[model samples]
Target: MTKRSPFLELDGVTVDFPIYSGGSRSLKKTLVSIGTGGRIKRGGGRISIQALKDVSIRLGHGDRLGLVGHNGAGKTTLLRTMSGVYEPTIGRVRASGRMATIFDFTLGLDFDATGYENITLQGMLLGLTRSGVAGLVDEIAAFTDLGGYLDMPIRTYSAGMLTRLAFAVATSTDPELLLMDEWIETGDADFFQRAEARLKTLIERAGILVLASHNLALIRHYCTSAAWLEHGQLKAIGPVEEVLAAAGLSVANAALAGRQSFSNAQ
Candidate 1:
């Protein structure tokens, strides 16, 4: 096969937010008047966070893309942009298949509700019909292993309980594209073992799986290709071994490291 073009394309993308040291939000009363039209429409009010910069990427079928970056290097922003959470301030994002993003410990979990109730709520958020959640309720609750606690309020559950429920529900449907950021942070070794097994199954089913994490071993073993992103741009992109070698990282057989790749970007 000659191989096909990417199912998704992002060319010359950029996202920027102003650093309102003064009162940009209150500037309406201080500077520009109402309906100026020509001036930038930041907001009706002020203070902002410049979360992302000029970032661009492309994804094709069978691409297990890994995103590596520092704490605020815009990994989450890029993932959100890819998933249509936040529209790009510039450039374009064209994707062929449906995209799903799994960020945060219990992103859509309702704390006031029972584990059972939250599963239904999360399924609804994932766009699953009532019958869909009802069908999977038993499965998700069983995997969570919270026993009868499934009937208790989510606020009573620990972070680990919430994580298990979230992962179980999200993976049950097998989305076309799966985007994740540090998804396994809430479990013990035994639970992680089970979660890892589930993740492997998920990767096998999805056409594209993109994950961003500081976990080196996870990236090397799970992802076939990795991209080092810094200052909102891709520094290096290639096979796990090649990119890690260029960054002077051993990544040992079972080791992880910090974002020591900025030197190579210069």
Candidate 2:
């Protein structure tokens, strides 16, 4: 009995974002100048930044991939590309699983809406129907443990409360492909305990997890494989230890400190 191949594939994938001068950032100006298809040009004074360049990756079931790199290293861009938020400028990206991205917990949340209402709104943003989210209201509410605060507007909620509600709603459904920017480590000690448990459960249930984190120890402990991105390119992809070593990290020390393995790059 042999195993199946990966459901996700990226080949020569390139994503570009045009750099508009401050004056040309207005909607009217942007609309009139929507011509460049992700390439550099001189006459237009519009330059495109290649956030990802000829990058390739393959992810299979049970693959926990750790994305390692610096702040502008295209890790998040690659994750967004995989999540279908950004279309490739030069190549192709294909996947065959239900994907959920937790890039920013507060991204689609409504500050003026009550916690309960925002849950429905966020759920809808995840491609669920209003009725679909309504059905899970109790479960999500229970997970947040906000009690009466659920009726209050999100603007009234504290940072920890916001995080709790956001996390609960984000993980309400089980997604086959889970893409996370980093480990959730905010909130108080008690909340932290609960969040840790919930995160562990969610990760276990996910068939594939792509975690982009600066914490190398988490990567070494959780991910069987790693992908290192540097300046909008795939630097290395292989076993965790090997990739860390290639990035000039003292793997043993990094594992103990829970710090980033790419100290040189940082």
Output the number of the TM-score-best candidate: 2
Candidate 2 regions exceeding 4 Å error are 1-6, 22-45, 251-266
Deviation (Å) of 3 in candidate 1: 17
Q: lDDT tens string, model 1, 1-266?
A: 56344366677677666566554457564455455555455563444565665566677778898877676777888888787777777788777675666775366677888888888888888889989889998888777788899899988877677777777877777767888876455458878888888888887777788888776777887899988777777777889878766655564622434333222212
User: Candidate 2, residues 1-266: lDDT per residue as tens digits?
Assistant: 46444377899999989887664678765555565444344765667898999999988899999998777899889999998889998899998777888888777888999999999999998889999999999988998889999999999999889999998888888888889987876568987888888887888888898998878877887888999899899999999989877876565655633544344223
Residue 32 C-alpha lDDT in model 1: 58
TM-scores of the models, in the order given: 0.82, 0.85
**Could you say which candidate leads in lDDT?**
2
What are the clashing pairs of model 2? none
